[model samples]
Target chain A: MTDIALRGVDGLKVDYLALVRRRRLYSALLLVLFVALIAGGFDLADSRNAGGFWSGLSQIFDFPVELVREAINKGAALPGNLWRYLPAMIETINIAAVSTLLGAVLAVFLSLLSTRGLARWPRLMPLFRRVMDTMRAIPEIVIALVLIFVLGGGPVPAMIAIAFHTAGALGKLFSEVNENADLKPIEGLSSVGASWFQRMWLGVLPQVMPNYLSYALLRFEINVRASAILGFVGAGGIGAELRVAISWGTGRYDAAAAIFLLLFLTIVAIDQLSSHVRNRLVGGH
Target chain B: MTTLDAGFDLAAAKRDAERRAFRKRMLTFGIPAAVLAYLVYVAIAFDIAGLAARARMDNARILLADMVSHKVHVTRDNRFDKTTVAIEGENKGTYADDQWPAWVVREGASTVVALEAGNVVRFDPDAVRFDIPDYGVLEIVQNRTGITMTMPAGATPEWINASSSRVTVTRPEGRLTVTKTRAEVFRYFGGWELFFFTLDSPFHGKDWAQLAALAVSGERVRAGESNLAAMASDVWNNAMWRHKDVAWAIFETVLMAFLGTMGAAILAVPLAFAAAKNFAPAFPVRFGMRRVFDFLRGVDGLIWTIILSRAFGPGPLTGSLAILFTDTGTFGKLFSEALENVDRKQIDGLRSTGANVVQRNRFGVIPQLAPVIVSQVLYYLESNMRSATVIGAIVGGGIGLLLTQAIQTQKDWEEVTYYIVLTLMMVSATDMLSGWLRSKLIGGR
Candidate 1:
């Protein structure tokens, strides 16, 4: 009887050990494969590149050095350059801010229309979801470029393009937040014979408002970057100015540096500000 | 005394409630009011009123129409007395003399174009004639002196714009323009012409059923190659559409996103450890690393792209590196925060067992961080696909470069539509893929 009990325990131990060994081996193999993939990808990219990675590495800092040196040489004009581009910088911010606002408002409707149980027409939920997905799938540059063709080069094209993307992005997030919301209020509002808009406004909006704001703020930061990029491709802003400055080559790099500094500072400021607000909003809850 | 105290407390509660109500009321009205004011200002600043004047409805109409339909140009060069029929008036799409579209027939000196909506345009050696269904026939003749137009009718319509050097008659179905050197007529048709196979290919005009039948048959389209192979090669190398180049561009964009994202994640892992307070005992190292990450992120991808493009001279490498540099900062910050949040008990448990620092981190910390790392990296991977398109435009490498080039030409709206559809597919595919991977790897988080 003692020998049989000992054999049973040994069998169990052996099986457990084998399972762990297999798991470890699988992990190791996966790691090796991952590393190999990275190395292979690097080699492929290097080969396809116009300039080889090794040769480009040395010249990576050349532009920045020249930019810095020129800025220093034209240190006296730095303030003037910054001031001159201030309006363009403001336009960039305004694009982000207005798009965020418009997108958030649009997202509120889309989220309400798409979320299960919360939707006005529950059957059309997938349709609305697909709409948002399609909108989100399209890159802002695509829309901005096309709109720039029709609307001409300006902030409006960038603003509309960014807003279109923002609506889709924020709508997805807003719907997710809506899913976790307390349905008791909505039920109670409906019990009181409230309209769909009233039920949503009075019940659901209050619950999801903080989260919506937090996500919208984060999106604003992203949109700022997007708007600037759109501007680079001819939609108007500080990015267009930066392009012009950079294209002028060595002599005008000072202006480019000034614009870069402004962009950097603005981005950092927004990043810090949004994160702070978001922490308070999320943590206070 | 008890009644007085109760009453006083009730009064104080009522006052507090009233104050709260007032604040809520103010907020209900104030936020929208503020938004409306801001929008008004933005409207003025962005010149919303002027936009109506500057919007160019004609451009919008052209873009919308061209995206769905294509036009074939039939020109009779008076100077050379030679006629040519080309799709979108491109040299690559020009038809050989023996094989013009059936709608366009050359009878001796004149070429007659049968347009839709009962509109017919005939391009002669020295004159162009347009026969509209409702309106009478309009004739424009190019003489040695100049161009002269005779509008059939009671009055000259606004659609016909005649100048000394040129005469243009525009209609919904087609357009005819007569000039000193040439008489041209454009006939509009729905659907993209020669998308799969150009006119030069043997498979160009074959229907799907015929192509499929031919593809399976033993007979070869070209002597050296099979029918299927010949068809594919023709489509892939189609000069007008450039399907092969577009496919390559799409791959390059995806490659940029993958390499940039994975590379950043790889590079960030070690740096994250150095930045994490629990892992790094030294404050200066953590502080410096955090600052470096901040500097990397603060400079923005735009700046990084410009700088990298200068070094790499515009390619996927520059775009990838730009993404790598920017995302490294983002991953470092996110990873270090995650590292800081790691449960110390796990490490302590490993340490209690005869594990060194390396072993403890490998066994305890990495397991805990794996899910967060995987989820974040996958999320960035999806987003980075979109970024790669934008970056490609700046660096001149990917589908974005193709898209911008198409748009810049200002005539290839159909090609632009193709690229847009492809880009949308690529992005959505990445999104779905990343979502699936995340769910699989992170257990449906």
Candidate 2:
């Protein structure tokens, strides 16, 4: 009886060791495969590239150095260049801000219409979800380019394009927040014979408002970057100005540097501001 | 005395409650009012009123129509007495002599174009005649000196614009333009023509049933390949559509996103440890590393793309490097934060097991960080796919370059539609893939 019990314990120990060994082998194999994939991809990209990776590595700093040198040489005009592009910078900011506002409004409706318990038309929930997915999938540049064709080059195209994307993105996040909301208030509101809009406004919004605002603030930061990039494609902003400056080549790189500085400062400022606000809103909760 | 004290306390509470309610009311109304005022200002600044004048409705109509339909141009060169029928007037889409569309018939010295709804345009040796259904026939003749138009009506309709050098009659069905050198008729038809097979391909006009039959049992169309292979090769190499190039571009875009994202995550993990306060060797290293992250992110992807493209010249590698540089900063920040939040008990438990620092980190810390790292990486992978498109545009590679080129041409709206559909599919596929990967790797969280 003693020998049998000792053998049973020994058998259990052996099985445990085997399991651990198998897990380690699998992990090691996965790591090797991942490394191989990365190396292969790097080689493929290097081959397909116009300039070889080794050659390009040495010249990577050439453009930046030239830009810095020109900016320093034209140091006196730097402030003036910044001032000249201030309005364009403002336009970019305004595009982001207005699009965020419009998108948030649209998102509120979309989220309400798409969320399970909150939806006014419950049967059409999937339809609304698919709409959001399609919108989210489309890159803003695609819409901005198309709208730029119809509407001509301006901030409006960028605004509408960014807003279209923002609505979809924020809608998904808003709906997720809505899913976690307390339903008792909603039930109570409905028991009181409140309208769909009233129940949502009075009950659900109060619960999800903090989360929605935080997400919107984050999206605003992203949208600012998007709007600037759209401007590079001729949606009209500091990006358009940057394109013009860069196209002038070496002599006008000072203006380009000034624009870059403005863009960098603006992005960092907004990033810091939004993160601070988001922390307050979410952390306070 | 007790009743009087209680009543005074109740009155004070009511006053405070009323103040709070008033503030809430102010907030509810004030925010919307501020937003409305700002929108009004934006409207003025962006020139919303001027947009109506600036917007080209004609262009919108053309884009919408061209996206769903194509036009075939029938040209009759007066000097050479030669007639050619081409889809979208492209050289690649020009029909062979005997394979012209049935609607266009060559009879002796004239070509008759039968358009929709009884709108017939005939290009004769001397004159171009357009017979409209409701409106009377319009004749345009180009002499040595100039072009002249005559309509069988009291006044020439606004659709007919006749100048000395050119006479153009535009209709819903078709358009006829008569010039000194050539007389052209554009007949609009639904669906993209020659999208699968160009005019030169033997499989150009085969229906689905015929194609399937050819694929299964029919003899080979070319000498060296089967009918199925021939058909696929023709479609893949179709010059008008460039399906092969498009596939390559999509692959390049995905490659950019993958390499950029994975490379950044790989580069960031070690840096994240250096940046993390609890794991850093010293305070200065952490501070310097954090500053490096900030600088990397602050430069932004746009700046990085411009700088890198100048170095790498315009390709997927440039796009990948740009994404790598920007995302490294983002991943570093996120990863370090995650590292700071790691449970101390796990590392302590590993230490108690007689593990060294490396072993402790490998066994204890990595497992704890795996889920967060995987989830963040997957999320960024999906987002980076979209970014890759934009970067590809800047660097002149991938589907983004194709899209921009199509749009820039200002005439290839159908191609634009194709690219847009492909791009949407590509991004959504990546989105779904990343979501699936995240769920699988992180145990459905």
Q: Judged by DockQ, which candidate is best?
A: 1
Can you write out model 2's per-residue Cα lDDT over B342-402, one digit (the tens) per residue?
9999899989999999999998899989998999898888888988888888889899999
lDDT, candidate 1, equals 0.92
* All candidates: TM-score of chain A: 0.94, 0.94
Per-residue lDDT of B1-100 in model 1, one digit per residue for the tens?
A: 3456644687778999999999999999999999999999999999999998999888999999999999999988887888999998988889999999
**How far off is residue B63 in model 1, in Å?**
1.8
Tens digits of lDDT, candidate 1, A95-146 = 9999999999999999999998899999999999999998788899999999
Candidate 1 error regions (>4 Å): A1-21, A248-251, B1-17, B143-146, B153-156
Q: List, residue by residue over A1-285, the lDDT tens digit for candidate 2.
A: 666587798887897899999999998999999999889988988888999899999999999999999999999999999999999999999999999999999999999999998999999999999999988888998999999999999999999999999999999999999999999999999999999999999999999999999999999999988888889887989889988888733448999999999999999999999999999999996
Docking class of 1: high
- Give stretches of model 2 more than 4 Å off: A1-11, A248-251, B1-18, B78-80
